[model samples]
Target: MPSKRKLVAASAISLAIVAGVAAIYQTFGGESVTSSVAAAAPPAAEVDVAAVISQSITDYQTYSGRIEAINYVQIRPLVSGTIVAVHFRDGATVNKGDLLFTIDPRPYQAEVDRAAAQLASAEARNGYASTDWARAQRLLTDNAIAKRDYDEAQNADREALSAVKAARAALETARINLGYTSVTAPVSGRVSRAELTVGNVVSIGANAPVMTTLVSMSPIYASFDVDEQTYLRFLSHDTKTTVPVRIGLANETGFSRQGVIDSVDNRLDTSSGTIRVRARFDNADGVLVPGLYARVRVGGGAPHQAVLVSDAAIQTDQEKKFVLLVDKENKVQYREVKLGEQHEGLRAISDGLQPGDRIVVNGMQRVRPNDAVKPNLVQMSGDAATTKGSS
Candidate 1:
């Protein structure tokens, strides 16, 4: 009977061991179940990716420059004399030949009168000499007077004729001096401050410095300099095509005038390696002035159809230029591109892009290679009309 009781106890212990093993495995299985639940959750979708496409990408370039007068001239006193009067007010508009100052014309006029009187006297003497010479010829022909007396009269007549010519020359010189007494403007323009006082002596002499200045207000010159690289690059692309220009004062917001290229520098400057280019604008409003610094823009390059993207879209890593190209499937692929030239805010994609190829513009930093994305295609319009796919 004791043996039977022992066997039953052993069987109960064995069943308890089997149940404990099953419980341990069940707890671990619960942990695995929780992990699977978390992993099964869906991920957030990516913002729609849009490809950068083109409309009309304009060809534009930028350069720094200054405003200049088309006709710049200096006002100087023409004659030497004491300044008697200031004809025009300082900083006044002057017409061509407008009197700017008055030299002491009293002295010049007196000299002119004296020369005129001398000329009259010389003319009277000449008339007398001519009559005497004629009489001498008649007397010599008839042998009415001694030959020596006739010869003496002829000599006096010749001297009087020479004196008349000298007097006439003196009168002309005096007239020129008198005209110079009134200093006049060489060109029509705004007169600068008076360089000479009313009482100061001025001329093309020791005090003959510039008395005033005049710069043509109409048809102003916009002078800008381009580096040698640019000149060569632009010239290589376009030859003799006129580039447009615009100018405005610093205080003035909107550009007040428009113009075109008038001339280019004769030679490239070796020291600075820059060439000066000038454009002419009609400043009929008299707003532009000489020496006023301004911004300049020019457009000249290979003529071809091209796709343009915002310069900001271009990303650079090390020495390579690259862009993020979004395919129609909303897949982002990094593309290496060759650049042409930048115009305004857009850059020409010389290679690696085609017309209507969408590109990543904003929010490009969050993207990675081969990352799945949802694309929100943005339309290119307005200034984008200038964007042409690579040619």
Candidate 2:
């Protein structure tokens, strides 16, 4: 047997060797477990994808507008008189030349009769003077009257003729005033309530109060403003080609009314960088009212090939717009895009995208860039039919 000190040293060495072996085993075993876990990965995320559509599209820009009447007339009296009768009901539709009000024809008729009597008296005097002049001419030829007396007779005839002409002119004036007693519609339109009712006195002149208002019922106007860039790009190119326009009411969803650009402002407004444009629309149904809100859409030039996609595919990344695209390696990629006009339910991709490019339309939030995805191919129109594929 060894001594006590030797035994103690031998035991210590044996224990240290066992501890070293245990540490090595634990380290290797832990590494093996970690390696096994790293080899496995979660399943690819499922997402709806669609191929960008290619089609010829005409770009259209929309703007807020207002409906206006083609013809807006304010009814006013031409002569001053007491209103004797109102021919139209309040808010009645009247045709051109339709009688609207009668302003006491009795007074005008009396003046006309007085003028006629005065004209008749003047004509009688003129006849007598003419006969006297004829007699004076005969006396002068026969030398039966003095020269001065014949001259006086001739002068009297001329004066009487002048008086007759003056009387005839007065009669014509009286007849015109009489005709003014009846206030007629100058245009065919819907009229407002009479401002001056029966027994109300109306005055003539520019300062005269409007008796009522009238607005045309058909072929109305829709006015809107177009930005300078849009006007230069679309409207300025073709001076003669009719620019197509469409309008919708406040409650309408789409532009239901078709119209043509009627007139454009001569100069663009520098302050707003826009040009005022007016469109003519047929209001035969009498549904369009003046001063009503309207939505105006102006179509650009000829249709051109364009790439389109559904709005759902577009993602907003802070200030920039992008879409999640799936690559052939079953990984998601980011694509920045410039947007143009919207047609139907599809948005036109102005730049940064091509036709047939697969983009994630649904389940975009579940995936990130370079993420593997199980793409379910669907139409860009959001149809139900789909095909499963790994992307």
Candidate 3:
């Protein structure tokens, strides 16, 4: 027979074996196991979810360009002389035909006086010759004077008339030179500083120095280059007639000024595979200036419906871009998407999404694929904070 200590040890061993079996059954047996495990699992993650947005979106192609003046002119002296007076202040707005400078007119005035005196002297001589010719004609008719004297009188009268015509031409030239002494603005625009100051002599002809520069202010031009593909697209649309364009300064974000396509290059540049394009915008406020850096957007295509989603919701995996989608059962799934141009802080999804699909816009990092989520459905439009969940 066994001792009392052996009996106690055997009893303890049997009880431990029974307890272990009971614990296993509770953990993996049947409905109790399922209920216990389900109770232990944590609740679904709360997330901000938004349906894909659908709208008629217009696409635009952006390019960096420069602003140019519609009309630019370099003011130069017409006649050579010392600048006796400056009629315009530096950087002042001037009108067409406004006096800008005055050259020394004394020399030209003296020439005019001299030509006038010569004309008067020639006229007096012509009168004397005419009278002599008349006397010779009468003497010739009477057959009392030599034909040589009559011929000399006729020749003298013709010479006097020729001298008078030459003097008159000289006087007209002198007057024109005198007028050139008063330099005038050739265009209406803001003028630059005077290149030649008062008392400085300026010369005319091809070597003449530019006195100032002027550029038209109201309508300005913006020039840019477009690639072969873009050029073809523009040609298909016939952009020159009514293609819309927008412009913004370098420091600005969105294009604030509107313009129209004015011209396109005749041929594509073979070296760069691009074509030159120009746009014209009204600058009535005179804020746009030449050589300014510009950001331009050329409109493309007609309006079409596009699916957009918040860009922040997109996640990248290696080379593939994806988004977290919430199904009807509130289960999260990974969806791959193709993207297009971004507008208003959202990205256009070209494929792999529908307008009615729900995407996890926020708290995506906290959820995993196939995980359940407590979604707060929100409208993608308007203020993000003000949006309320429909679910």
* Model 2 CA deviation exceeding 4 Å by range: 1-50, 134-153, 235-241, 326-333, 362-379, 382-391
Clashes by residue pair, model 2: 330-391
Off by over 4 Å in 1: 1-63, 66-71, 145-147, 222-269, 272-281, 295-302, 316-321, 365-391
* Per-model TM-score versus the true fold: 0.70, 0.75, 0.76
lDDT, candidate 2, at 228: 86
| Ranking of models by lDDT | 2, 3, 1
In candidate 1 the C-alpha lDDT for residue 168 amounts to 96
What is the Cα-based lDDT of residue 93 in candidate 3? 80
lDDT of 1 by residue, 1-391 (tens): 9999999999999999999987876968877878899989754235433345454544655677888876777767777889989888887887889888888998889999999999999999999999999999998889898988998899989999999999999999999999988888888888888887889977586656888778888877888888877677663334534655666567753345667778777888899888898888887777777899777766665456777777667789899998877776677789999887654446777788887777766557878656566665554432332223422
Choose the strongest candidate by lDDT: 2
**Worst ten-residue run, lDDT, model 3?**
382-391
- lDDT, candidate 1, equals 0.75
Q: Higher-TM-score candidate among 1 and 2?
A: 2
Tens digits of per-residue lDDT, candidate 3, 1-391, equal: 4698899999999999999998888777778877898999898999989898899988878888999988899888888889999989898888889999999999999989998999899889989998998899999999989999889999998998898899889889989999999988877878889888898989988899998888887788999998887777764455455777889898876688998888887888899888898999999888888999998888776889999988788899999999999999999999999988866667899999998999988888899999999998777743341256443
Q: Model 3 compared with the native: what TM-score?
A: 0.76
Give the lowest summed-lDDT range of ten residues in model 2.
382-391
